[model samples]
Target chain A: MTVLDIQNLTVQFGGLKAVNGLNLQVQQGELRCLLGPNGAGKSTTLDLICGKTRATSGRILFDGADITNLAEYRRARHGIGRKFQVPSVFKELTVIENIEIARSRRPGLLAALTTFRTPLRGRVKEVLDRVALTDHIDSKAGNLSHGQTQWLEIAMLLAQDSKLILMDEPTAGMTIQETLKTAEIFNSLRGEHTIIVVEHDMQFVRQVAQRVTVMNQGSVLAEGTIAEIEADARVKAVYLGH
Target chain B: MNRTNHYDFLGYVAFAIIILLGVPFLLGFDGFELNTFARYLALAMVAMALALSWGTAGLLNLGQAATFGIGSYVMAMHLKLAASTGNPGGMPDFMGWTNVEALPWFWQPFQSLSVTLLAGLLLPAAVAGLMAIFMFRGRITGVFVAIITLAFMVALQLVFIEEQRFTGGQNGLTGLAPLELPGWTVDTYSLPFYYLVAGCLIVALLVGMLVVRSKVGLVLRAIREDAARLRYLGYDVAAYETFVFCLSAAIAGWAGMLYTLVLEFASPTYMSVSFSLAIVIWCAVGGRESLVWASVGAILVNLAEGRLSDMFVEGWLLILGLLFIFFVIFLPRGLYGLAVAAMDRLRRSPRTEPPVPVKEG
Candidate 1:
């Protein structure tokens, strides 16, 4: 039940190897947290898996399919969804319209032209309810608060029905209460969806991560349960600033 | 539909009434006045067309006049052929003057009115589709698209002017015969021709409105906002961009054809950079966000230009330039945004309370 398998993944930017010889595997319905200091190539690895960055040499097998050379949209079609550091949503469109786009079965131009707006009743309502954004469904996405905008992006991923969700710093720039709520939402999604989160806040990571993978200088330094990684001397010296 | 869309639909209806009924009633049947208005209406279609890509898809196509000129030349070629049926060698006067013995192979198909009409629409779309595929597939966006499109327009204009024998060069295709239908002829300076232009404008506007209200339009707006975000959401951003670009190009071409009919000629001037830029200005002044408002902007600007030029003569161009600057500085969203703000104020004045949230289970 491996949902994602990366083997010897490497991406070099000119003289720098941003992500080199990275290998990782995630099981279905597993909530894995990726931990690293700045410039540890955590984001680069995610980009490679999601087809945003082409690997210099490696294979990314998602759901048993080798998708190393697939386009970004093709990777997304294969159920890979990514949430960036900044909240990204259509600012001018209503919340309902944004969800409708993500929930669209056929995102082609011809299909979109013929698809009616009124028929998006069930799944749209369900995802909105899950994100607790049902009340603000008619408001413009730009008008949403920062925390709300982040939740709306999560709601969009839910509406997209993505099998594997890749989130980078989901709790960044949030108050304590909002972070706790986001942690709660992640916990709720753990058993039904496979998620890989790259987070800086250790407390947020402890709340949601079933297992931790620590990366440094372009490769995985260690992988273990949270308690095990905290006691590792190498992790302490490189990442925890001991 | 939501409240905003409902308001938008009402706006379209009011616009239709103004163009179809109000203007005709005001102008009466004076051929000169009607012809001028008809030309303005046709030009409005190009403005709306530009708004589709520039406003919705975030593609600023500065070479829109290339497609427009293609459409004009196609229609003019047909009319030129139709008018030369009795001339020596049965070819256009320009061709005969240029010492061409027979009609060129490319111009032969234009002899058939059906072919000419279809070509007028399809040629522009196809050309635009090709350019869009090239640019969008390469992930080119924003100002780069504008520069490339502007360059192509200048190149196309040069081709038309330099190829004197084929495209009628600087003089363009003139002395076009009246369009002949089953039992009637379309005289350019007549009521029927004016109605023809108006009817075409209405249909074009309806088509533009339909595009803006569909899910495709929703995605396009998203593309405009953040194309990279849409791409990561399992949508081919380039495909959507290309679709809208081609649609806009086809509409611009249609406008060009109507313009040729209104003015009785197709010239290299139609493909000039200034003409394409003027279309963009009209769209910007009308509020590029709303198609109807963009058309209104074109008509209003043209009307002002016509009147002011007559009154001030030497200084009218300066006045127009200053007015454009004022609109760009004060009303960045154009008149539509202004109207929307005004309406929002009026709606909130009486209620004084925030709207109640409709809870759903």
Candidate 2:
């Protein structure tokens, strides 16, 4: 089934079309990579999907339901999660506390007050182990290294039980080993959750992308398997700068 | 609760014991001293209210005194009516003195103590809710919230002062009668009355601590650190902000009601900008990060103000101003930071060597 279907998605910032007349679709549990150079509107597409930015003309459907104008948090509750290029985690809270909040069954004022006895310790432990951050569970999130912070954000998304995850350059500042570790994590999540990754690292994409969508100048230039995309003359000329 | 919260609980217990039993019995506090301490406790309640909204939730509400004053006036109105119930004329003395022949229609509802208490708590919360709907719903926060609240408070002060016939004008609500309970009438100046004030403070502290250590606190701190991120986490940022804002206002209102009983009056000055600022100062001085310290800071600051003003008369303002500046400059974390650091040092002193030994060549 189609998890995310974007129709004629157009975003205009005063005559400069960041994402113009774009159309894309992702199947459930499919790992798709969005590839482009600078100014390709890849990030803007993610923003539009997550309701962070309003489109000039578009419709977004998640799991066959129209979510075009849903508020960001509502979309999040509907199982849409995004990881920015920069890691954003609650810096002051401990790692377990951070995951516990996201893992809460009912995250609201009254539940928070009365249900203090159940701390989500078991769920937090499982997420911490998944991210290989079991030792840092009690440490403040701010004390973690850059790579660890990124992993913790991924753990947060996992704890959120997001059905679809949008990642923007998840390995932007990682060491090669850290990048490979992240690729392994994403590879492991392929069939369980739908994933759309926008990345500049071709090597990382080669490792995990089942299908690649190449965008340029605010529109999809090519969409195919990795081999088919690499052989496309238009993609090579527009994105590869051939 | 974890280790830190466990320690905080112990600290609260110690504070409760000290105030309830130690001060009057061991410290030998007389009626006057206890009454003064009771007044300080009331102010501390206001400071803790600020700590919840400003320190925890990252909202700097500069108009807190508006809510506090509202609570005070609501209770004072009830007390005035209670005192005047048996008189030949049903009207309070202020209504007669101001030459008002009849009780205003609005003052009729406060005749019931339960209604008065509910209004005393809910009125400020309702006002805060309206303000929150306007400010937070529109995503107004930080300095703008501060400015709007301060302006709101100043406006309320003017309205209270201008409406002379109803609000008692500049003289304010004075000559209030003793609050009558079911069987025992509360003597405002007595030891039991002081204990009642202390008990309120203890309850407020316990509730505040529970909130600060709960998942609510975690989310509030997250909102403080990064509200936008919290929004993306499927949490309604505005709702949480509004909830904390109204909750804080309710607490301030509750404190204001007790403050009226302690002082035996309510004045327009209670809602003034300076009074609101003083509450903020107390929170900052004690430690906005910790509720216990914030309340202690309020009491300590007020105690210092009383003693210092008595000694320095003319120079007290100058001295306090210098100390505030010093605290702002050198101790940005406030007194709570100092306590945390000292505790950390004490804990580390015993662990002189690493648990795992290194093998030397």
Candidate 3:
């Protein structure tokens, strides 16, 4: 089933058209990769979906609901989690505390306030384990390494319990081995939730994302399997570099 | 082990509480008016509330005094009216001069102690709630929030001063009676009043402590640290801000009602910008994150003023300004922040150095 439906979406800022007439859809629990070079509206796509940026004209349907105008928190409660390009975990909070905030944010206010209503602690542990961050659960998030911060951000998204997560460049500053371990974590979470990831790394895109969308100049250049998109003439002409 | 980073600090607070409680009995009586101490405790109520909202939540509300003043004046107006009808206390002179044959309709309900108590909390809370809705929902934050509220405080104070016939002008209402608790009339100005203030301080602290220790406190901290990330995480940053703003003001208002009983009058000075700034300084000196420290900061700073005024009266404020700078630079976390840091270092150093079971106790 289609988990996200973007139709005739456009975003304009003053005189600049950041996004124009983009149409796309993702399947349930699907890992869709959006690839583009610099200034290709890759970040803008996530912004529009997450309701952080305004849409000049568009219809964004999330799980059969029209969330075009829904604010981030309302959209979050309906299961849309977001991660920025830079690591955005709670720095002053511990690794576990950061997850606790995420876990609390995704639920209803009363549910979030009352601990006995749900086993938030165990669920937090589960997410920490998935990201291989269980050992540093009590450590402050600010003290983490660059690669570890990325994993902590992922762990935070998992704690929110949102079915669809929007991640911006999950492995931007990671070493090759760290990227492989991140891929393992992403692969492990495949069937349980949908993830719309934006990354410029071609190899990482090919490693995990089943289907890929290539955007260029505020529009889609190609949308198909990773191999098909990597081979497209238009993709190579605009994004892959001549 | 969690190492009790939270409780290690509480140990000092527990010691302080014991001293505060035992002081009255230990000294026997030092000509200290019980009524004034009660009043101090009531003011502490406002201090505790200020700590939670501004210190922990990172909201700079320059109009907290405005909220407290509103509650105080409203409660005072009611008390003044009650004295007019067969009460032994002299009716407020302003009422007699205004040549008012009867009390205004709104002031009628405040005559009842139960009703006055209810209005004391609700009226200011309602006003604060409405103001917070307009500000927070509009995404107004930081200096804007502080400035707009400061403007409101100044404007409200002006309104109270100018509408002299109603609020008794700048002179304020005096000759007011005290709150009559169950089986006891609180007229005497002894430790009974001090105990009353102490009781209020305890309740307000308990409530503030509950708020700061909850999951709500975590969200508040997160909002202060980075609100944009909070929005992306699917949390309503504005709503949380509004909730804390209103909650803080409500507590401040509660404190003000008790404060009126202590001072026996409410005036425009209650809502002055200087008062708001003083609260901020108190929180800064005590510790912003720890509510208990904020209270300690408020009381200790005021106590310092008393001693300094007796000795170097003229240079006290100058010394205070220097103290403020020192706390901001060297003690950025304030007193509580410093204590928290020291505890963390103490907890961490054990494993780093030799690791011989780490005699934590």
Candidate 4:
């Protein structure tokens, strides 16, 4: 079953057509990689799906519901989570606290005051363990190394209990070893959650991608399995030019 | 372990004890001194309220005094109405002075002490909630929030000043009757009144502490650091921002009521930009990140200002300006940061240790 469906999506910035007539669909529990060079609307496509950037004209259907005009938080509540290009964990708070904020079932004023004890501390610990960050749980997120921060961001996405996860360049600043670990983590998450990850790293993409979509000049140039996409002449000429 | 947080907790307890019990008993303040101290506490309450929004929630509310003034005016209006009970038409002295025959409709509900007290908190909170909705919902933040709030306050001050017939114009609502409780009336300069203000200050401190120590406080700090990240986490960042804003407004309003009880009047000057900035200075000096320090900083600074002004009337403000500059440069975290640093140094020094648990015993 399709978890996300985007039809005739377009985003315009004044005279610039940032995204134009992009059509994409991701099956539930599927791992899809979006590969594009600089300014290919790869990030913008994720933004449109998550309501970070409003579509100039498009329809975004998520889990059989039209969330085209939904507010960002509302879309998130509908089980969509996006990890940004740069690690965006709460720098002032500890790792556990960052997870706790995301793990909250309901983060209302009354819930914050009356709940007294955070019931999700154990769940947060579990998430930290999953991200291999249990040892650094009490440390401030700002003090974390770049790769660890990325892991922490992933833990936050996990803690949110999202049905669909959108990650923008999840392995941008990661080392080869860290990238392999991240690929392993993505492999582990594939069966439970639908993921659309945008990346420029060809090796990381080859490792994690089941199917690939190549975008260029705000439009899809080709879509197929990673092996097929790697062989496409158009994708090579536009994105992987020698 | 986080040594700074531990020190901050201890500092809060020590400050609370000093303000709540030590000063009233240990210092042996005379009636005048006590009344002055009460005023300082009221000021501290307002400063702490500002800290809640500006420090914790990352909201720079430059018009806290407007909410505080509104709270003071509500209480003063009630007192004036109560005192007018013996008048021919039950009209306040100011209303009669403006040649008004009947009381304003807004003044009618304030006649009931309970209603007035509730209005003091709820009215400001409601106003702040509206402002937060407009600003936060639009994602207006940083210096813009400050500009909007400051402009809103200035406009409210003008309204109060222009509507002299009802609000006593620039003079504000004065000649208020002593607050009457079920058993007794509150005398302005009496020990009982000082105790009443002290109780309010302590309650305000407690409420601030409750918020700053809760899981909500952690989220608030997160929001301050990265609200966008929170939005991606499925949290309603704007809603949290509005909640803290209204909470701060309510606290400021409550402090305003206590301020009126101490001063026996409400004035337009209370809502002035200078007064609002002064509240910010107190928080900055005290350590805006720490409520206990924020409150203590306000009271201590005011006390020092009083003494300095008396000693060097013209040069006091110049001295304060220099001190503020010094704090901003050398002590960016304010007095609380200084204390924490001192504590850290003491912890580090070999001389401060107990010789590694002596084996003699």
Candidate 3 or 2, higher DockQ = 2
Against the true structure, what is model 2's DockQ?
A: 0.51
Residue B194 lDDT, candidate 3, scale 0-100: 70
Provide the TM-score for each candidate, comma-separated: 0.96, 0.96, 0.93, 0.95
Report the C-alpha lDDT of model 2 over B82-188, residue by residue, as the tens digit: 88877546788877877887888899999888898899889999999999999987989789999999999999899999998899877789878888777879987
User: In model 2, which regions exceed 4 Å deviation?
Assistant: A117-121, A240-242, B26-29, B86-89, B97-101, B353-361
Which one is best on DockQ? 1
For residue A19, give model 3's deviation from the true position in Å: 1.1
- Provide C-alpha RMSD values for all models, in order: 2.3, 2.7, 3.5, 4.2
Worst 10 residues of 4 chain A by lDDT: A114-123
DockQ of each candidate, alpha-carbon based: 0.54, 0.51, 0.46, 0.41
Off by over 4 Å in 4: A116-121, A240-242, B1-7, B348-361
| Arranged by lDDT, best first | 1, 4, 2, 3
User: What's the lDDT for candidate 4?
Assistant: 0.86
Colliding residue pairs in candidate 1: none
Worst 10 residues of 3 chain A by lDDT: A111-120
Q: In model 4, state the lDDT of residue B352.
A: 67
DockQ-wise, the better of 3 and 4 is: 3
DockQ of candidate 3 relative to the true structure: 0.46
